[model samples]
Target: MVQAQVTRREFLKASALVAAQVTCGAWLTGCANALAASAPPPAASDAPAPIATPTLSRELPFSGWREVKYYDQLASAVVQCAQCPRRCVIAPNARGFCQTRENRDGKLYSVVYGRPCITKTTPIEKAAIYHMLPGTQSYSLGTAGCNLACLYCQNYTIARAKPEEVESYTMTPDDVVAAALKAKTKSITFSYSEASVAFEWMMDIAKVARAKGLKVILKTGGYINEAPLKELCGALDAINVDMKGFSQTFYDQVCQGELKYVLETIKTIRRENKAWLEVANLVVPGYNDDPKMIGDFCAWFKENLGDDVPVFFTRYEPAYRLRMPPTPVETMERTYKIARDAGLKYAYVGNLPGHTGANTYCPKCGKLLIERVGFDIKQNQIAKGKCKFCGETINGKWA
Candidate 1:
């Protein structure tokens, strides 16, 4: 199938038009129409093909290797990946734990650069980032790897596979920005899988999106090193970090990661204060649903990330390697109360549609500010980022 490449000139024109619309307070209807009209149509033979199932294939394309940053070359044709805490020491022609970065003749390169296995325009809430751009759509995409090995990964089909094992479409940074503009989305998100595995691709696309006055949101697992995490925070407008569980033992056994690094990543984001930060913790039954553990988690969250930061206690379903039953609704309710009692203003229970906990309320007056059912926003009472009833300032990006 033929692929269309967007030229730099076309990107600049599209970005300029979007900027003008934002400045003049014009509706996105005209801007979207302009972008669609200017964009080149797909050739008749270039219709998108169905995505392939993940399987080992030697014939898959593997030529897209771009030099990676934040790595140290070691002796005897070995390299250490500094992108994440894993710090995988890969020998020549070997791959890191993520399986997306490889060592080619002692040089670490990203094999999934500009090759996205999934792309769609989805509600921001679906990313579990309930605060930023609440009701708006975000152009979301992800590559085919993850830094962690979570046993119950929902997207394990691609996240657990090697880059060459999945079918992907090549999209440059300009192509991604153009697609977002054409879709009439004001933000771009790197989601679905562990986006930290495709750090280079996301960073490049974020740079272009930022220049076009579009926000960049990362729905990540928060497993990166300090240096790279700080660098990524520079271009990010918002982030929703998944905090899996509270115990170090749980992390080591279930996620193949450590609790300290994830906490440090959250701390780094809060310290930088450059992006809107939100956190979610999936409550697995009989695992992390202990009342004491929940309370401890909430207390630590309140102390480290502050009480204003939104925290979500989501129900976990059986998937991947885990055979556990779905979390009980009562467990989620209890966890929500625990978070609220810990002084968190916006504590929520996710994965249970139509629950009262899904709505955002005013912390001071206890007035319902945003009414939501699942990912859809039914009513929003917060105007100009302030509670309409008590006129108290809400902590989020609302326009």
Candidate 2:
């Protein structure tokens, strides 16, 4: 691993950086180094996780900025973005809260459309999606800027930075598809920062990914408006929505977001029945870890998402503004029990490798279905979407 890491700063010597070895922003060499160098050290928490780098490059054209498709122009050169539930009303020359969308004159343009700071190839399991193409590779990418203000964001190095603050690449949708193909990945994933913040790039890549018979997956906070989400779902094959917490108070205090909007986002995606959906709750200690709150969360999840949709209660590590200790394994176990007790068919735990909670068990015959070691699959007992032991029908898009 002594080889030079690819970042927008030193890697852009010519053009066309490889998709597998590029990291984002300044801190990422692009974001990891550049942003981390100038960014103030977190006075409250440990440093955020490093953005992994991708590799290779070819010169591609940068489009400056792409005009967004969802927005409403108002009088006096103001516009309201319809992309996320925030619906930021931006003035002329102003930017949205995500800092990736700007109102230039009267039109809203996506500033991070083709200028991702990172595009590393990883396993689909890292996307927190276990039901689809287990063990298959996923080509992932992310840009700077995030919509919500999560106090414990793990990738805050890129999430808190602006596109201008980071070194970026001119990766078009076709370029992304070509890279994914070169990497021999089964899906193209949008992750790292709030993927929806770079909605245009994701959508364009999804279209090309689909035409080329590659799956499209998303790891999102699910804080999006109804209309734009439906269109996004049309191309997405799988989605892992981060259900921050179950209560409104948690959202208000920790994330500075509305619980209602995220709830609607989940419902809209499920109701649309387009993408295979999974939910993850990062178990932040003492914040969203109350037993009663977890029970309520599971009950609501069972009622709304039913039995098939996989749910995860993952561990939270200290990062960004929040300096809480890593979530206890006991707490993770507690949430998993609560989810299963509420009659959920599929419940898993993450951020802890070698834990049995990471394995997939059959809801019907109580058989071990998929054994996973971190993001790697050890043994897959479920075959052809059915449990090998009991022939029970499993709910997932099997490879």
Candidate 3:
């Protein structure tokens, strides 16, 4: 379509000067014509201009800084952070438990904004959100730092590193949207490490992405405060919340977070009627793999989030500070059966490729609606979000 309105000759002539200047990083427009003449072939110059690119911006890549747009300074030099449930009253140079935000010199400044250390375009299915949009791709990006210190965190390299310890590129909100457009992704994910930690950047990028009709997904631990979550619900399309465990003991001893707060966050997400919500429980052996506990968890989910809310029991590997053996595949299969018995309609076993339980089955007819092999989708049998066999509508955001 760009070619229909503008001929190659006119387009080339119009863009030659800007292209020459940008290519040479030169501001001397007097030499633009000459530069274009001596430059490479017309085919090179005919290439379309980029939507947005990287820039020079510095943000801390650690759990060591505070960022807030709304806060008040107390007489004791404490800043009241309204960002998360932590609502930390931070003293100068002190950090939150998330270890990313900090109070510096009586004011709060989030240091991870616009400086993402990890950025890539990946399949949306890889985010493990099978029901949201199957086989679509999303632009995934994240900075360092997390609010929760889950000992079994899978991406701890960037998740646990400081700004100086990792490499990052500067980008604005527009750059993120451009990256999504350039990659032909249908959605963008604030993922890899933790989306809540880099809230400001995400808010900005989501605005532009939504304007462009691109979807947004939040791959989170559901450790965020209410206000931010509500603000984010405006632009977010889907969310996958990690339900680490069912008990406070596991939340404190294993994840170093509050179970009640995570539950509250999930409830709020459901109440807001915002975003397609899915829950994931990492089934760690000898930690949270007990059948009774898993059953209780499933029952709670069925009551609170409903039976239609899909739950994923992901097999845990030995990583980070926990060097224990990986969870047995048999255990994951057993848990899947337990969840099924607990009245949950859509329960899945993740991280074990080619497992029969990895595919999505119709809860009513017991027919496979979607087939999977690892992250690859081998087959899809749904028509307009209804089961092909039973004609019952699947409870998910299947677009």
Tell me each candidate's TM-score.
Answer: 0.86, 0.86, 0.85
Candidate 2, position 45, lDDT: 62
1-399 in candidate 3: lDDT tens per residue?
355678765654455444433422222223443456666656766753344433222335445333566466876778877766667777888866555567778877777777776666677877868897788878787787777778888888878776546655556788778767766789988887877877877887888889998999999988888888888776689888998988888888888788998898888888888788888899988888989899888878888888888889999998898779999888998999999888888889999999988889988898988998888889999988999988999987777
For residue 64, model 3's alpha carbon misses the true position, in angstroms, by 16
Off by over 4 Å in 3: 1-46, 49-67
Model 1 worst lDDT run, 10 consecutive residues: 49-58
Q: Summarize candidate 1's per-residue lDDT along 82-194 as a digit string, tens digits.
A: 99999999999999999989898889999888877676778889888877778998888888889998998999998998877876656778877877776678798898788
lDDT value for model 1: 0.83
Q: Write the per-residue lDDT of candidate 2 for residues 1-399, one digit (tens) a residue.
A: 699768775655434233322332221233334435767777556654333234333322235688898899999999999988888999998999999899988999998887777777788999999999999988888888999989999888888987777666666787778767766788899998898877788888899889999999999999887777898888799988998998888999889899888888898889999999999999999999999999988888878878889988899999999997799999999888888888888889998998999999988899888999899899999889999999999999997
Candidate 2 error regions (>4 Å): 1-62
Question: Which should have the higher TM-score, number 1 or number 2?
Answer: 2
Clashes counted in candidate 2 amount to 36
Q: What is the C-alpha RMSD of each candidate to the true structure, in Å?
A: 8.8, 9.9, 9.7
